[model samples]
Target: MKDMLWLMRNIWRSTIRSKILPVYLMLPLLGVFLSALTYSSAEDETVLRIGVANLDKTQLAEDAVQYLDGLSHIQVQMVDLSALDGEVASGRLEGGVIFEQGFSEGVHSGKPGGLQMVSVDGEQATRHIKGLLAGYVNDLDAIARIAKGDETVFAELYNQARSKSVSLSGEMVDDISADQQKSRQSIGYLITLMLFFAMSLAGNILREKENRTYFRVLTAPITSRSYYVSNMVVHLFVMAVQVIVTLLVMRFAFRIDGGLPLWQMFVLLVIFALVAISISMVIVASARSTALATAVQSLLIVPTSLMAGCLLPIETMPAWIQKTASFLPQRWLLDTLHSLQQNGISKDVYLNISILLAFTVTFSLLAVYMFERNEDTRVFV
Candidate 1:
């Protein structure tokens, strides 16, 4: 045990002293943080500049403008009718809602009304505003119909909608709103990508083996098993640096919360990263060559990561793929972290930590067995 501790300290010191580790740990973090910060600041709480051009210029058109301008998330810019397209094209406005001439006359006269929405970017928030304003017009149509003693018909139409809507939780939720679920899903993908650094670390392991330094270590008082234990310690320490860099970048550079209880977040990262470490060990032990290692990493890491909900929301994927993801460690780790964020730490947190430790132990044993039984000349391979 003392020897293991001493070996870990020596290897950790060597890793820290190396000129490459600092650079390897810094540039990627800076890049990730810069991208995240730029994106978050640009997208967050952006008050949409919406132009209102009333060609009709009547009381009803002005009322329409008033209603839209009063709503949240939009800054109504009253512009001249001629500048509507120019403002939209020049990016001064997110979109313009133009009421055609005689809009109120058409409404009072029981004729169709034409409204145009123009924008350079047809983003979601703008689309939602357009939908809301369209609904406002539809409300006018309903009110016009109601004025003709058509109460029975309106009741029947409302009943038809009520009958068609049945919720899973038995609560009649009338609105099917997009609730930024994608942001949380994207969060999941980022978490998976961060943990999946194991593959690169595995590649790091293979590089060390190729350099013949691994064999030189084995020739000292270190046995094959002890050498692997030291490597595991080294891998964990390296991943600790990775997590620190990632967190600092995520917070200061990207300006993201990255979930709550910051210490717990690091703990979750360590647990997830341990699984990646084990997976890397399995990859290194299973592969016969560097070419084989790369190929196997592509095959294993790419597809499993896809299934584990790293690239996209597994909830959106087909049922079979989601079910199959249970076999992947990435899925469990992600699910664990998500559960932690959503519901505080649950029993599943302990289960995931145990499962990851089990995987690490199992893979470490296999790697040791492979190293011991193989010819000394090729044990590193």
Candidate 2:
């Protein structure tokens, strides 16, 4: 135990003295910041700008403008009739709604011209706005028929219907927030960074072998087993620091909403970190040289991370790619994180946790077996 501690201390000193700790830590922080920025930019895209040209100059046209303004996802601007086409053509407006003259009288007489939607861009925004206008016109048509050509009766009933309020009450079945998407993306990038760091640490074994430090270390009181354990301990310490710093920056500095409790999130990340370490061990055990280990790490980490939804969303990938991702540990960790965010530590959380542990143990056992069978890498017993 004492030897392991001493070995750990030395490894920590070496890592610090190398002066690359900040660089390694900076990568994950940068990833979190970039992901946050990307999500913020995307949030702005959800709102559509619409222009209204009221040529009718009647209460009906004014009411239509009010309805458009009331939509939560739309920003309505009352523009001159001539500006509507230019605005839509220049992309200043997603689309335009034009109310022709006598729109109100025509509606009352059941002879209204069809509503016109102007758009240069063939986007669904125009279609959605048209649908909203169609629904309002339909309601007005129903009210006209109810009045039976009586202007006074139509005006009375129209005003009453417009002023009428329907009470609506319902609990939110799913607490969906934009912040949840931001958290998922931030954590995804962080997981990729963690894997890269783990691989770098695992390659330290190859570095020691290259520099002949492995033989010298074995000559001391430390057994090969203690040396490997010490390395694993150091890897965990570094990963813990990375996880804590990233989470703190996300929660406090950036004000990201992590739908799960901080402790639960920390626990989940730590468990995933173990999987990363085990996979790194497997890489080191399989490669015969430092270069081969580095090459193998690059080949495996990028593709696996891509598959695991660390680099891109799993849903965007092909069906077969997503299916293959189910077999990867990173995917399971992300799944658990997503579950915690959506369901808040439900029963399925345990299942995901168990799967991550199973992956870690499997990788660890395989790495151990590989190390044991290969006498050439006797430095790791």
Candidate 3:
């Protein structure tokens, strides 16, 4: 125990004196701030701008325009038919809806109406606009069928339908807010940065070996097991500090709503930190030199972090890539964060935590085996 504490203290002192520690400590803060800025800008961009060109000048056309304006995700503006294409092409509008002169007449006569959607954007952006217009047309078609060309009765019934209301009361079975999504993304980036920082311990171990301090330590009363344990302790301590500082900044400084208690997030990150440390041990154990270990760490960490949805949401990736993410420990940590946000400590959380713990133990045991079998590496000698 004494030897372990002494080694841990030395590791801490060395880290404090080194230039690399500040870089590692600053990475999470910078990453979180940049990500938050990006997310804020993206949210602003999601509000679609649509233009309505009502050539019919009828009650039905006016109603259609009003309905479009009422939609929560869209901002509708009244515009001329001549301006529709120009506005859409110039990027002032996402899409335009054109109501022809016979729009209301066609609905009254039970004939197909002329409603055109014009947009330079792809089919996906205009799809929702088409759906909304289709709904209005369908409702008009139904009213025409019922009225059988009686305009006065149709008008009366339409107004009556608009005014009628039915009471609705029910408990929310599930709720996933936008704040939760922001929190998940923010936490995901932080976790990825922590994993990368944790892997730096491999370089530390390699440096000690290169300096022959590892041999000097072995000559003392400390066993190789105690030295390794001390490394794990130091790595975990650094990770914990990173996690806490990032979370506090996210909650207080950025005002991000993580959707879960800070304690829960801390617990999840600490578990993932263990997995990261163990994986670092494996990398260091497998490499015979610091350069090899550094190369392996870079090659594995960047690609795995990308696959694990650390850089972007997994849902946006291709199906096969998402499937590949399942094998990564970072993916499991993100999955755990998502589960906690949505379900609030359910069976899924336990399952994800268990999977992370399994990864930690498995990688740790493999690292130990490699350390014991490899005689060229002086880390455990």
- Give TM per candidate: 0.72, 0.83, 0.85
For model 3, state the Cα shift of residue 337 in Å.
Answer: 1.9
Residue-wise C-alpha lDDT for candidate 1, range 1-381, written one tens digit per residue: 777787788666656666656655554464454445545565577687899888887766777888888888789998888988899898888788888997765655445386777877766536878787877777656654654545455446534643586556566663212122322343445445544455655565566678876566667777767766776778777877777777665666554554556577678778766677776777776666789888877777768878888666688889999999988877777777677666777798888778767876777788777766642656454
Candidate 2 shows a clash count of: 0
Candidate 1 C-alpha error for residue 55, in Å: 4.1
Report the number of clashing residue pairs per model.
Answer: 0, 0, 0
List model 3 lDDT by residue over 162-223, tens digit each: 89999999886644365677777777777777767877755777777787776677678976
- The clash tally of candidate 3 reads 0
> Residue 201 deviation, candidate 1, in Å?
5.9
TM-score of 3: 0.85
Clashing pairs in 1: none
lDDT of 2 by residue, 1-381 (tens): 888888899888776665567777778888888888987887785778888888898888888889889988999988998888898888888888888888898889866564678888664658888888788888888889888889899999999998999999988675447778778888889988898898877767777777767667867886655766788788898889989999999999988887877888889999999999989988887777777888887898889989889878788999999999999988888899888887787889999999999988888888877765543545343
The better-scoring model by TM-score among 2 and 3 is: 3
For model 3 the local lDDT of residue 380 reads: 38
